[model samples]
Target: MSRNHAVLTALAFLASVLLPAAASAKDSSYGFDTDRDRFGWAIMSGGNSTTSDVEDQEALDKLKEEYGGDDFLFLREGDDRYVIRDRALIERAQRAVKPVNEAGRELGEAVSEQVHLALGTSKDARERARLGRSIGRLSREIARAARRGDDTEDLERDRDKLQRQLDDMEESSRDQRVTVREKTKTKTRSEEASRHLKQATHHLQDTMHDILHDAKARHLAEPMR
Candidate 1:
């Protein structure tokens, strides 16, 4: 063969050998389907179904095997239609929980610190009463934060400690209030306010602990967790 014809022949032979291997690599990378349009359809359907009337169960199975079902928020039933219970609400809630939990933790820590400081510096009956009320308010905030459902065991433990501290403060405040009122000959009540406060705090703490434990258990049960 002439020089130019020999180069062309070699080029053709290289293409023949490389083309099939390249195609096979692409197939392995993206799976059996090589069409970009079909991949787009698969992704759009949330890997549930590929095309109209084409079950695409293979793709769905691959997705479930890889990413798990919970990671995907939508389920594909038909080609063009999907089932979403509350897309906007679910997305909003998912986005909101993280920030709310983080803010709650920071606020709880600050409140706990202030309560500790107040307990140490309180000298007189009035000072003790003021600190007690402040601690009580902080305890309520911690309880509310816990109800938001982002607490870990550590967070729950800290919250429980804060609640107990608040209960102690309230009891001290009630006794001081009674002493002050009796000394001045004013009408003093015999109601057990501290007991009620303690009960409320304990109830909220227990509820929060249960919620956190349940969440942890559910997380452990998830396939990809």
Candidate 2:
């Protein structure tokens, strides 16, 4: 009933097969094709064997919450004694969104620094769209400072800082756009991969279902937007 119960069952055999010479050797991570630990997959080669499951409701609830998806699915070959979960898809989804999230963090830091500089000085007009302007706007700001008989040094310093951050923010936006596109693309690929897995099961005369009676393995990572 535990998450690793089925995996441990298969893994014990794997350990024996992979390390027949070494008894009591610690388990090391292994990779074949795309699947890793918890990223459920069965390979055609002897490297990986198929897994099976009946739905475990508590596990399914937890998976839905973690992934924010009701559409989480798996393939069960009819009576094959192994069910394949979508952990790989969840992992890919999270990775797809990572670039955008990192870019957002950088943009926030830059904007925060620029905001502080703007607030500490005389640019009350900074509330408007003045902060993310062109270098020409910086010139106007310097000229205006001279007319106000104010020292232009502070304004120039802040202008430089704001300009650099503005550039960073723009770049971040572009990166986010690209990452979102990638998320969509990856989602499609994941669906295709799942279909292929289903086909593999079908060839073995196993049945595929959107809902399994008791899915023991649940995909628990959230999808990235």
Candidate 3:
């Protein structure tokens, strides 16, 4: 019934509530999967394939005739004329959304840090509350960067709710209890950030897939080899 003992008890209760959310953020379900890792695509060429400008130009003309413009690249190695998706475009898309992925990881880390603070009896309550606000800020930043000119209403709403929760945490005088309550909502915040990250990754993946699908439809690219 001592003051320190009472505080320790409340902290333990809060840690238990927030720990699962923290663990979920740290898992592989996080939004850090890069485009290359998600795609696992390889150029269709053989061992005897040797690069030739003459054959490449000829192949390019053929591809242009079929697929219109530079959407697909024609690679001529030896007798193997393989058509592949434009990797430069995919790389460019990945670069554009790189900030989203980084922010996702940072958001997860921040959630984990807040949970860690809650579990420690010596940790500061106000520090944990500040981290809660940080998580909200991260969510909004990810949502903005991930949208890529599209209207992300659902994502925007999630980020807005998170920001509001952070505002509540900031204004609360009971830092210890409020911080714990806010950390409990880390699940929602982590999920919002993750959803944005996945959207960004899918955007790049879809771009690559669209070109691949096009080539397949035109019989320029073969899935088997």
Candidate 4:
């Protein structure tokens, strides 16, 4: 096959194996600020040697031997040090984001299930109250998931239905107490908003692991030196 076709085929295979909902959605930017510094120069802080000191190929070879291979990218930092980033630290940092995504996803699923149960119950004032609470919670969860780049279409659809139902219930009910103690905010961040983080994080970790391993292996096999 042609190179472009082959590339497309490879991407198609990945899509087939990955979560369809997440793969089809637009890129998310929920934790960008938190992860912005996670992937730059890998280096041992304080103890790192300056790149200026490696004046020859022999010095560079020793540096390569110190790290894994010479194939990895090397760059000078503002401190004038030739940095070899702490891959282990970077890996851990990347892994740290996993829990956040998971929290978002699991929380979203839990809220969605709660909403489902509320909808199944009798449409009494109390039920309206329950659903009214669920609608707000679900909206936050859906928004969180959307922010994390997960497909919230299904959840959003359900939330919208709940809103419409709640509106109808409110209009017909003479009791204003149904919404008297409505508490939209929560102490927990995940509870407030974040449901899609799990799905996105899982896929991201998997993809990053595969790519990193593959590239490292490929380069190690053909060392730059």
Best by lDDT: 3
After TM-score superposition, the amount by which residue 179's alpha carbon in candidate 1 deviates from its true location, in angstroms, is 27
Write candidate 4's Cα lDDT for 148-217 as tens digits: 3457688878876876676566556664333423313221333344434544554554443444455455
lDDT of 1 by residue, 142-192 (tens): 334333233335544554464455445545753333333332221111012
Clashes of each: 0, 14, 1, 10
Compared with the true structure, model 3 gives a TM-score of 0.33
Estimate TM-scores for all models. 0.24, 0.23, 0.33, 0.33
What clash pairs does model 4 have? Answer: 42-84, 42-85, 43-85, 43-86, 51-82, 101-197, 101-198, 104-194, 104-195, 105-195
Q: Kindly give the stretch of ten consecutive residues in candidate 1 with the minimal lDDT sum.
A: 183-192
Query: 1-225, model 2: which lDDT tens digit per residue?
Result: 232442343334323323312123321111211211223222111122212221323343344465453334423233233323455542332343233223323333333323222221223323222443233244334433332234557766765676555444434442222234443353344234323333333322211222222334353322222
**In model 4, what is the error at residue 159, expressed in angstroms?**
1.9
Q: How accurate is candidate 1 locally (lDDT)?
A: 0.34
Rank candidates, lDDT, best first. 3, 4, 1, 2
Question: Superposing all C-alpha atoms, what RMSD in Å does each candidate have to the true structure?
Answer: 26.9, 23.6, 14.0, 15.6
The sequence of per-residue lDDT tens digits that candidate 3 reaches over residues 1-225 is 333554454445334322322133312112222332223322212211111112233444455566554343433223444566545543443454455456446555544444343332223444434444444444444533343333456655765565565445445534434355565475665665557565655664455466555656776564323
lDDT of 3 at 101: 50
- Model 1 vs. true fold: TM: 0.24
**Location of the lowest summed lDDT over 10 successive residues in candidate 2:** 27-36
Which candidate model has the greater TM-score, 1 or 4?
A: 4
